[model samples]
Target: MSKKKDNLPNPFNEQPLGGLLKSIDGFFQNAFQNFQFVGGFPVYEYETETHYIIEAELPGVKKEQINLDIYSNQIKISVESSEVIEEKDDKHHVYKSSNSFQRAERYIILPFTISQKDVKASYRNGLLKIMIPNKKKRIEIE
Candidate 1:
């Protein structure tokens, strides 16, 4: 009867609770999977009126694997990974490789002039520290 049909809930208007839960579960699962691709790598930058210091944490990486370049008002750091292979037997083996990682270029505008020749760097405990010294005043002879 028309009255009985009206009393029943509309199928199209009904919410799919199971489907909503499934979608939320799927989203979290995919996010967790993607997080595994990104490991831990932190960079710290400190600057004083006289100098600047940049430190990077690079564990399990060699000093030769890192590259630092200085451009006008900017500094770029990058890391290159070496290929490694492991052979368990004639039919079983594993190959591990990674492409180079391009770090973000840090832009620093100096309050005063600086000289590239005065820049000094050191690596210790999986950390790379760079010290950039401000240019010294030169006395002029009249």
Candidate 2:
């Protein structure tokens, strides 16, 4: 009797597996439902001796929807999206309507010493790339 009891697994009492699954579900729920997390707004940063680069994943976003503010010690990135894309056939009958706005004011703040005069930004293929040169150097890298 004792051996049989030991062999049986606790379906509702075992916590390791259940707890892990619950946490995973909560993570996604919070990230999506609140809109504030948004998977941390996935970003990558690189610093060279001459410049600093920041690349952020922003799919389905237009170039006009993005804004940036650069200060001597901090950089702020804001993305506001209010786009309504529609497609029509030759008959002028609209069948499809698309709205590409999953987030608004997705602000990213970071600290760096950068020059404002030579700041460059571009968006291509769902990615936003911004380059800021170090304040101490005016040399541009090609």
Candidate 3:
């Protein structure tokens, strides 16, 4: 009798449907957040004891297409492109067309004091690197 009771399966062993549904819902929420599209450039900020580096992944964009504006305590990057249409042929024959685009603005706030004069920006291999040196005090811009 004791051996048969030990071999019997527990009737309470079952999957909790509520807990499983919650887990499935959480997975979909995370997947949707990561799959969203962002039109602007992707940027990352890195900091050191002496300086801060702001790098933007700007592929297929020309060096001249980006503009950096340094305000009182913020740096804004704006890119603009436009498409132009050129018609080389007439009516029913043939036509050559081209499109242009304009870049939009991206803003970043600085955690440390940075002067416009001490900032350096460069573009290499489709990446835009901006180096901002640390300053103890704010410098007046003339």
Candidate 4:
């Protein structure tokens, strides 16, 4: 009988808990990969008999930090905000400060065309409201 060759030590062997740990890590990474840390506000849209209304909730956002634009068939809303924090220690003479900025944008499409001159927007108490007149033209039958 021919002698069997001895197997060398394998470095590629999986540890008992390595696979489980790796799977858990991967799950967490994928779960939070596309998560937004800021800028995902809620919006509501509805239409009345003569006009369309859109409302957006923007808590803690100042009017200066918001930008609104109305096109012939769509509306665009953008918000930008920044925060700063400071810490001071008189005894140790140490001071620290940090700043963070966040931005978010959203677009809404209208079922019908709209005129820029007929659009109105107002912001109050953390709510932004927009009104667009409905101008449906009637077609005469031949």
Best by TM-score: 4
Residue 108's lDDT in candidate 1: 44
* Per-residue alpha-carbon lDDT of candidate 2 for residues 90-141, written as tens digits (9 for 90 to 100): 7866365545445444444445555667788889997989887754545789
Segments of candidate 4 deviating more than 4 angstroms: 1-39, 138-142
lDDT measured at residue 103 in model 4 versus the true structure, 0 to 100 = 76
Q: Which ten residues in a row have the lowest lDDT in candidate 1?
A: 96-105
| 2 versus 3: better TM-score goes to | 3
Residue pairs in collision within model 4: none
For TM-score, candidate 1 versus 3, the one ahead is: 3
Model 1, span 96-131: residue lDDT tens:
232223232334454455456777888898888888
Candidate 3: count the clashes: 11
Worst 10 residues of 2 by lDDT: 30-39
lDDT values, one for every candidate: 0.60, 0.65, 0.72, 0.78
Model 2 scores a TM of 0.48
Residue 140, candidate 3: alpha-carbon lDDT: 100
| lDDT for residue 90 in candidate 1, whole number 0-100 | 43
Rank by TM-score, highest first: 4, 3, 1, 2
